[model samples]
Target: MLRCNLICIGKLKEDYWRKACEEYEKRLHSFCRFTITELPESRLPDNPGKAQIQAALEAEADRILNLTANTFAAALCVEGEPVSSERMADLIRTLSLHGTSEISFVIGSSFGLSDRVKEYASIRLSMSAMTFPHQLARVMLCEQIYRAFQIINHGKYHK
Candidate 1:
C-alpha cells in the first residue's frame, strides 16, 4: 500500500477536529497506510516580531524535515499551488508509478512554514487561497486525501 503521512506542527485540541481526522483515517485504511505525526508547535509571545516568528518556524522546520527525510515531502502553505481533487489523485498515482511509494504532507504552525521546509518540499500544495485555522486545515487535508484515494480507486464515495 502507498504510505501517506500527514506531518503537522500542532495538535487538534478540539474534539470535533479529532473525530473528523479519525473518520478520514479509517476511510483511508483500505486505500493506503495513512498516518499522522503531530509535532509540538513552538510557543510565541502575544506580539512576536518577524525575527521571533522566523526563529520558531525554523525550529519547527527542523523537526518536520527529520520526519519527512525519506519521503517526497509536500509542504502545505498559502503560497503553494492550489490543486484539485483530480490532480491530487493523479499526482499520487504518478508518484507511485515512478517508485515513490511514500509521500509526506507537512502543515506548519500559525506563522506558517519556514523557507527551509518549503524549499525541501517536492511540491508545495494549497487547499485554497483563503486562510484557515491550522486545526481546521488539518481536517480538510485529511478529507482531501480520502477524496483523492477515492478518485484513485474509482470508489463511489467521491461525488
Candidate 2:
C-alpha cells in the first residue's frame, strides 16, 4: 500500500473538523497507510507584526522539514499548481513506479508557509486561490486524498 503523511502546524481545536478528518482517515485506510502529524503553532501576541508572523512561519518550517525529512514533500499553498483528479491519479501512479511509496504533504498555519518550506517542496499544490481555515483545509485534503485513492482503484469517486 502507498504510505502518505500529512504534516500540519497547529492542532485542530474544533470537534467538527476533528470528526470530519477522522472519517476521511478511516476511509483512506482501505487504500493506503496514512499518518497525520500536527506541530505546535508558535504563540504570538494578538495583532502581531509581519516580522513576527514571518518568524513564526520560519520556525514552523524548520519543524515541518524535520518531520517530513524521509518523504517526498509537497507544500500546500494558495498559489500552487492545481491538478485535476485524473492528473493527481497519474501522479500517484508515477510516484509508485518510481518506488516512492511514501509521500508527505505539508500544510502551514493561518499565516501560511514560509519561503524555505515552499522551496523544499517537490511540488506545491493549491486547492483553490480562495483562502480556507487550516482546520477546514485539513479535512479537504484528507477527503481529496481518499478520493485520489478511489480514482486509482477504479472506484466510483472519480465520476
Which candidate has the highest TM-score of all? 1
Shift in Å, residue 69, candidate 1 = 0.6
lDDT of 1 by residue, 1-159 (tens): 799999999899999999999999998999899999999999999999999999999999999999999899999998899999999999999998899989999999988999999999999999998999999999999999999888988999888
lDDT tens per residue, model 2, 16-131: 99999889888888988988999999999999999999999999988998887867898999878887767777877789889997889899998989999999989999988778
Where's the lowest-lDDT run of ten residues in candidate 2? 83-92
lDDT of each: 0.94, 0.88
TM-score of each: 0.98, 0.95
| Backbone clashes, each candidate | 0, 0
RMSD after CA superposition, every candidate: 0.7, 1.1
Off by over 4 Å in 2: none
